[model samples]
Target: MADGERLASVTWLFGQPERDSVTEQAASPSQPTTADAPRGRHEPPTRAERASRAGEFQRINNVSMHALARRGMSVAEMRDYLIGREFDQHEADEECDRLLGVGLLDDFALAETLIRTLRQRKGLGRSGVTAELRRRRLENDAIEAALEDLDDDELARAIDLAERRAPQLRSLDTETATRRLSGFLMRKGYSSGVVRAAVDRALSRSGESSGPVFR
Candidate 1:
């Protein structure tokens, strides 16, 4: 009887704990654990898979080449173009550097070419050429450099334009003709002084007076 009583005690204490341990071991994988928990909400992105830079560079280069094929672009223009296409800024910058090195993107050269076109084809004055270069995103230094080689016949060009336009003003009085000619030259990007001189010279040529007498 004592042995059975002792056996009952042992079953109540040790046996219960042993069965609990085995149940825990069997149930462990099914239950959630610290290691099995989902990733934190604030995990850093460095561990995430990233696209290859080389691949990105090649794609950007392709896009840049296609854009350049259509028209010559300044460095800033190409940069804006790449950014508009959703390329990364740093990557776009590197590609621009590459293009500049290869002579594909040249702001100064572009400025020079545009200056000639603006002068010869469009009949723009120095101010007009400078404004156009600015619109094209050429640097200030580049604009200055391009303007340095500009043709020295600005006054002549302005006079030519004014003379051509003066005949239309023959019906108007001297004051009216002078005012109209001055306005036209100013809009063409000539300075106030240049406009005055051009108006006088042009009016003289159109027989408005014997010659410009500083008026």
Candidate 2:
């Protein structure tokens, strides 16, 4: 085709005010585009809904506290238990504080009771009692206070444990008996010095010459 014919064809194809039409559409405020459209309103929770949620949290706290009370749980133990049960940390802490405030949870009392029970019934030494208290999440101060009562009688406690265990090992030879007794006391968390002395007294009473020496 001739250049003038081609130019006329092009002009006819795109010569209309397409840009002006788009500009007019964009400038018109009557029509709202996606960006200009109003957003859906969000409703806040009602007072009743908030109260229901709070009631649910209280119920959970009450159930947990009651169960722990039945078992005589310490504050830390209850908190850990509640957390393990999927309770919120802040909620668990609040519940534990309530229990503590009412004396339903007492770490010091728990520690003292456990110390006595471990020593008298379980044949646990001071170290053993401390470890048990720590495992129960008792504070160090509570543990120390409880242990203070054991300071004067810890040796006697170890001796009683050794004497009780000595008879069972009577059939073994002296070396074997001493070795077994020492190991038993050590596993019970006794200090090496205490174990040695207790083993000696126990073995002597049980007709053994002396306790086995351990490095």
Candidate 3:
């Protein structure tokens, strides 16, 4: 009977350890795993994040304004400048529209200003002015609208340009002078008719196209 009691006590002690181990494991807090993480979460921007974005946009706006002050920029140009400066595209577009609403960025106005500059300062005629406006990336509607303001003065401008350049051709033969003068005026964006008329009038005035005098 005493041997039987001893064996039973030893078994009970061994079983207590296993029971304790199981109880401790069950009572311990579980560590969160990836499977327990929040699914499809999207946190809203904090105040600091919002402030940082505002400051960034303000800097972009200032840069655009300074660029405009330095020289005229079309709406497309301002957007490109902002994007090139690493601003977000959507934000850049928003700022551009804001400026446009305030009349600070006007494609039509820019086109008009460019037209005046090319015509008066650079002596470019209608086609040349249009080409330059397109090069500046103005909208097509703005380009057409701005061009409407131009007076019917292409012929006069062409004549003036030809007269200025005709004196240089006095040394060349009449045929050579005519050819060169025509090319020059054509390159200046004058039409063929305008070029022909200007070349003829210029040569006649300079006596370069005179008939042979009788001996």
Candidate 4:
């Protein structure tokens, strides 16, 4: 038999003898002893079992948090991931809060970093950045901060980006070149005025159509 069954059998066997004595002891409360001790500490979960439970929770938390960090999780994304897997919402919230409180997650900081990366590397525009930040569930404050900083010299950056890619559109006719440049600027989130100015400049430099190519 298993240890638990064996122990239970042994307990059952000795239980009859102890029953009368326990009743007598209970009837007389003049001198209490271990036999008269309340059925606490020895009942329910033992210390080892409690310790094991705590250890399991700790391990689960560590592995999950590390996996999330490795996967580049935002707070809401992490919450959604956990919820999609059937984790209790309250528990997920608690764990997410703990992670955020301990600096394991910072959505605002992440949004700023992403904004810089996309703008500098991908040549994305303000609208694109805002959409990306929204996808990450970042607060408006972070989005606003990123946008505010971008306004300082966005025109210069956009001009530089256009210059680098202008060669690609150069092969096309003047109408095509103007159309391409305007479309590019529009897709990059530039204002209509900015896109028009850039496209005019590009067409002029290309010795192409000076008339507006975009209707």
Best by lDDT: 1
Go through the candidates in order and give the C-alpha RMSD of each one to the true structure.
6.7, 10.1, 6.3, 12.6
Model 1 over residues 48-140: C-alpha lDDT tens digits?
324565566678889999999998898999999999999889988999999999999999889988987887887788998888899999888
lDDT of 4 at 55: 90
Residues 117-165, model 3: lDDT tens digits: 8888777878888888888899999999999998888888888887888
Query: How much is 125 displaced in model 3, in angstroms?
Result: 2.0
Can you rank all candidates by TM-score, best first? 3, 2, 4, 1
Compared to the true structure, candidate 4 yields what TM-score?
A: 0.68
lDDT of 2 by residue, 1-215 (tens): 99999999998779667877898898999989898886566866779979998997788767776786587777787888888888889878988888888888888998888877887788887778888999888888888888877756667878888987887886788888889989999888889999999988888775345532222
Global lDDT of each model? 0.84, 0.81, 0.83, 0.74
Off by over 4 Å in 2: 1-54, 207-215
Report how far off residue 43 is in candidate 4 (Å).
Answer: 13
| TM-score: the better of candidates 2 and 3 | 3
Task: Supply candidate 1's per-residue lDDT for 19.
Answer: 90
